[model samples]
Structures are given as C-alpha cells and as structure tokens.
Target: MKVTIDQDKCCAAGTCVLVAPDVFDQRDDDGIVILLNERPPAELHAAVREAADVCPGAAISVSEDA
Candidate 1:
C-alpha cells in the first residue's frame, strides 16, 4: 500500500497524524500535512487506511499495488 497526502487540501487539524503518526505528520510552521512515509510497511496499511478515512479535509489517499 502507498500513502499520499495533499497538503493543499489538508486543514492542518492533525487528524491523520493522530490516527497514524508513523505515516503522517504536520509541518512545524504551517502545520500542514507532511508525508512521513510515502511507502509504508504492509503491517501499517490498515492504520494508514484508517487515517485516510478519518481525514476531515480528504487530504489522504491510499492505493494498493498488486
């Protein structure tokens, strides 16, 4: 699974980071969404999906590569 976050769409609410700290974070100054891991381990796929689901701004995207 691959994860991507659109900073332009992010509200900086930190929901994604709160859901999956290993995959998402906030920039220090702007508090924008930051991609901590563009490609996370399979073990973390579920958590990454959860973060994408709960993102209020719809900033997170998850794709599965077969």
Candidate 2:
C-alpha cells in the first residue's frame, strides 16, 4: 500500500498521526500532515488505511499496488 497526503487539505487534526504514527506525522511549525512512509509494509497497511479513514480533512490518500 502507498500513502499520500494533501497538505493543503490537511486540517492538522493529528488523527492520522495518532492512528499511524509510524506512517504519518505533523510539521511542528504549521502542524501540517507529513508523509513519513510513502510505501508502508503490508502489516502496516491496515493502520494506514484507518488513518486515512479517520482523517477529519480527508487529506490522507491511499493506493494499493498489486
């Protein structure tokens, strides 16, 4: 699974980071979403997806590569 974040759309709610800290983070200054892992392992895919789902701004995007 691949993860991407739209910083422009991110509300910096920190939900993504809370859901998947290993895959997401926030900028200290503006509190924008940061992409820690563009390509996370399969084991982390579920968390990454959950993070995307709970994102208040819907800033998180995910793509699955076969």
Candidate 3:
C-alpha cells in the first residue's frame, strides 16, 4: 500500500493521524497531514484506508500496489 497526502488540500483536520498514528502524523504548528511512512506494512492498510475515508478535506490517497 502506498499513502500520500495532498498538503494543499489538507485542512489540518488530523483525521489521518487520528486513525493511523503509526503511518500518519501532523505538523506541530499548522496541523497538516504528514506522511510518516509512504509504504507502510500490510497490517496498517485498514487504518490507512480509514484515515483516507474520514479525512474531512479528502487530502489522503491510498493505493494498493499488491
């Protein structure tokens, strides 16, 4: 799985980070979605997808490279 975040579209809602702290994080100052791991383990796929789904700004993208 590949996770990417569009910072410009992100509104700092922190949904991505909230759903998957292991893969996503927020910038301390602006609270933007930061990619902690571009290609996280398969175990984190579900949470990563959930993060993308719940993102208020729709700034998260998840792709399955399997």
Best by lDDT: 2
Q: What are the root-mean-square deviations of the candidates from the true structure over C-alphas?
A: 0.9, 0.7, 0.8
Q: Model 1 scores what on Cα lDDT? A: 0.88
lDDT of 3 by residue, 3-59 (tens): 888999999988788789999898999998889999999889899999999999999
In terms of lDDT, model 2 sits at 0.91
Off by over 4 Å in 1: none
Q: In model 3, where do residues sit more than 4 Å from their true spots?
A: none
**What TM-score does model 1 achieve against the real structure?**
0.92
User: Could you tell me how far off, in angstroms, the CA of residue 49 lies in candidate 3 after the best superposition?
Assistant: 0.4
lDDT of 1 by residue, 1-55 (tens): 8777788999999988888898888999989999989999988888899899888
Sort by TM-score, top down from the best: 2, 3, 1
Task: Give the residue spans of candidate 2 off by over 4 A.
Answer: none
Candidate with best TM-score: 2
lDDT of 3 at 48: 92
Q: What's the TM for model 3?
A: 0.94
Worst 10 residues of 2 by lDDT: 1-10
In candidate 2, what are the lDDT values of residues 1-66, reduced to their tens digit?
Answer: 778889999998998888899999999999999999899988999999999999999999999975
